[model samples]
Target: MQENEVITDRDNVLFEAGIKLGALYHQFTGSPVNLDTVDSLEKGIQESISVQPCVEKISVSINRDMISSKLNGKYGYCELEGRMLDVHITAIFKTAKVDVSLAFDTELDYPLMKIEKIY
Candidate 1:
């Protein structure tokens, strides 16, 4: 952004949504999780992100199959990873609201963060 250029509401909404997604991915990716605790983890992430400015709402879902496949026979948990998360967020800044998401893209073999819609 140029120093004197205007920042629109859509731009602010997208920026806030991006910050939320980045925070969610980086802050929780290495945390320990098991099938039994997945629900709490999801809710925890949602609640934490919801408190940020301009965040209208947020959703977080962790892949249970992925968790199950990686549950240890002894320890019985796996570290949360970007590939195991399916997340979406809506942020409103002034009159603009934007939808954004972070999810595993199987074809690309990566977790992709994208802007889904703007209005």
Candidate 2:
């Protein structure tokens, strides 16, 4: 019983960290951007996450790739294909660590295309 409680506590910590990272990604990527914006976003997320009690360290990686991809075609509103940025965040918690990756389509007025957990 004691061991199970410990495991649950660790799991909770990881889950909370993941959620915080996801929210940070959404907040930072919800706008149009350039290299400078990306830099600021990374710094902002790291600083914000580091202040969390469970977080010990945080790292953010941004990948810039230009590709043609479908966007919001379901409602007969099609968007032009453009550059897509992949943002990866790694949060090291006191008891665990998590990696969250998200995609942002720069063509759209609002970024933040998708988000997922890497591990």
Candidate 3:
């Protein structure tokens, strides 16, 4: 195998993991809150990440915190209707390990959650 080929393969693994994480975030945001949402989300996220050819294992954790009051203008001022959540995703690939943290707010007009940040 050539040196460039090895590097390219590694890059591809990272790229694929990143894309899967983005898709997972999109799937979770703005989703309806229900008894089965958590279960479904976990299953979907795991399945999505694990499907990557380079992925070895994946772990997803979601933390939902209730907003006591409506967010004021200082805090990007959105109506407080749905929950705020922090999603942590870890993907272990054959050549790399990727950790993604996403902050989401689901109170906006759209059914999907608003992405606050990605770390």
Candidate 4:
């Protein structure tokens, strides 16, 4: 940016949303989890991310069916995968608010993070 450039709240929020999704995915993926601990894991992730700046709200959901199918015979738990997470976050900077999500896109076969809305 040039010296006179000004960053708007909308820009800040959009950037922050990407940062939040990236951090959450990297920090939590590969953690061990079973059906019994899934709920707690979701809550833990949400609470942890909620403390960050501009994070107004967050929701995390792990696909229980996917978890069950992916569990190995020897171990009753599976490592968390990006494909298993369905996350939504609302972030606000000043008057600008943005909603974003991380979810599995069947067409893309990956966890896709995208801006849902901005206002």
lDDT of each: 0.92, 0.50, 0.49, 0.94
- Report the CA-based lDDT of candidate 3 relative to the real structure: 0.49
Q: Per-residue CA lDDT of candidate 4, range 1-119, in tens?
A: 65977989889999998999999999999989999999999999989999998999999999999999998889789999999999999999887999999999999998999999997
By lDDT, rank the candidates, best first. Answer: 4, 1, 2, 3
TM-score of 1: 0.93
Question: Model 3, range 15-88, lDDT digits (tens) per residue?
Answer: 66567656766565565443325556656666766776555555654442333233344653332222344444
lDDT of candidate 1 over 24-89, digit per residue (tens)? 999999999998899999999889888999988788999999999998899989999999999989
**Model 1 deviation from native, Cα RMSD in Å:** 2.0
Candidate 2's C-alpha runs over 4 A off are 1-7, 66-119
Every candidate's CA RMSD: 2.0, 8.4, 9.1, 1.8
Model 2 pairs whose backbones collide: none
What is the descending TM-score order? 4, 1, 2, 3
Candidate number that wins on TM-score, 3 or 4: 4
Best by lDDT: 4
- Candidate 4: residue 34 Cα off by (Å): 0.8
lDDT of 4 at 18: 90
